[model samples]
Target: MEKEATRKKYNISVEATLEVIGGKWKCVILCHLTHGRKRTSDLKRLMPSITQKMLTQQLRELEEDGVVNRIVYNQVPPRVEYELSEYGLSLESILNALCNWGETHIIKKYGDKYAVLEDSILNQ
Candidate 1:
């Protein structure tokens, strides 16, 4: 398939991985989803820095890539929720490793004051 051929063109596994998750917000969104399913509003609240447009765009992309699931509820006011797909859940270890590396980098660059913040992010 064309998809298979495109994947083969990547020189390394990391390149392939990056293709799926490469963006300013994808990994951060994934990290938040790792906690549990979240409504659009909840995600926006959790990541106040992201604009609504960017969050919606990233979520749509993740859904298309089979890394996220979107659930809709019909009602007077529609409700939508997003969670990681099984394939997305498979990234848990990788996400944790990335988080750990970031924590280490922060500690190395700054100092211990930010270590507590890292712990909280890891716990979340």
Candidate 2:
């Protein structure tokens, strides 16, 4: 019974974490937030296609999940910054591996140069 309870707890934690960073945009957002704290405007600039509403929704979800922290600075205009929590940073290696794999597998297949070119000035 104790072992079963332990397994259930593990499953819940794993599933919840995956749910937080599971989506395409979520992972990218998390990766960008890892760089530093950023405002909604900054994130929009980094990912031009992401709409304001979607960005807000995603940020809200991440904050709710305890994967992100929102710092609101007191001012005439609210200066809110979003940053990753320690739990979020734990996925950095996993995200980086995905990046490397995408470069080699996805990008390489249909990159500008269809044929693999040797490193030479002529190839430039």
Candidate 3:
């Protein structure tokens, strides 16, 4: 009955959480937004490696998941700002723990120049 045990009905809630924050870039996005609201261009500026299209797509997913709030202003030049929602703020502890753990020991021990670039690659 290993199959039966392992194949229990999938829970939508768990899947939903994963859907929101499961991807390689979602957490990274959350990390940056945690500080304060930021304009779309500001995000791109800070993380120049991420393409605009991908950022838009991921932000859409995050907005759908109720993890982020996108505020648009009707100015002469349209402005958009992104900030984390209450649900997204819940990840603060988990994210902080990760940061602390990494800074305290992991980075010190590993000390690889490519460590930053290799985070998602090695994890996957």
Q: Model 2 compared with the native: what TM-score?
A: 0.74
Task: Give the per-residue lDDT of model 2 (tens digit) for 19-63.
Answer: 778875888788778678989988887777788899999999999
Clash number for model 2? Answer: 0
By TM-score: ranked, best first: 1, 2, 3
Per-candidate TM-score against the hidden true structure: 0.85, 0.74, 0.73
Task: Name the weakest run of 10 consecutive residues (lDDT summed) in model 1.
Answer: 113-122
How does candidate 2 score on lDDT? 0.77
Model 2 regions more than 4 Å off: 1-15, 112-124
Per-candidate local distance difference test: 0.87, 0.77, 0.79
Model 1 C-alpha RMSD to native: 2.8
Assess the local accuracy of residue 79 in candidate 2 as a C-alpha lDDT between 0 and 100.
96
Best by the lDDT measure: 1
Q: What is the full ranking by lDDT, best candidate first?
A: 1, 3, 2
Tell me, by TM-score, which candidate is best.
1
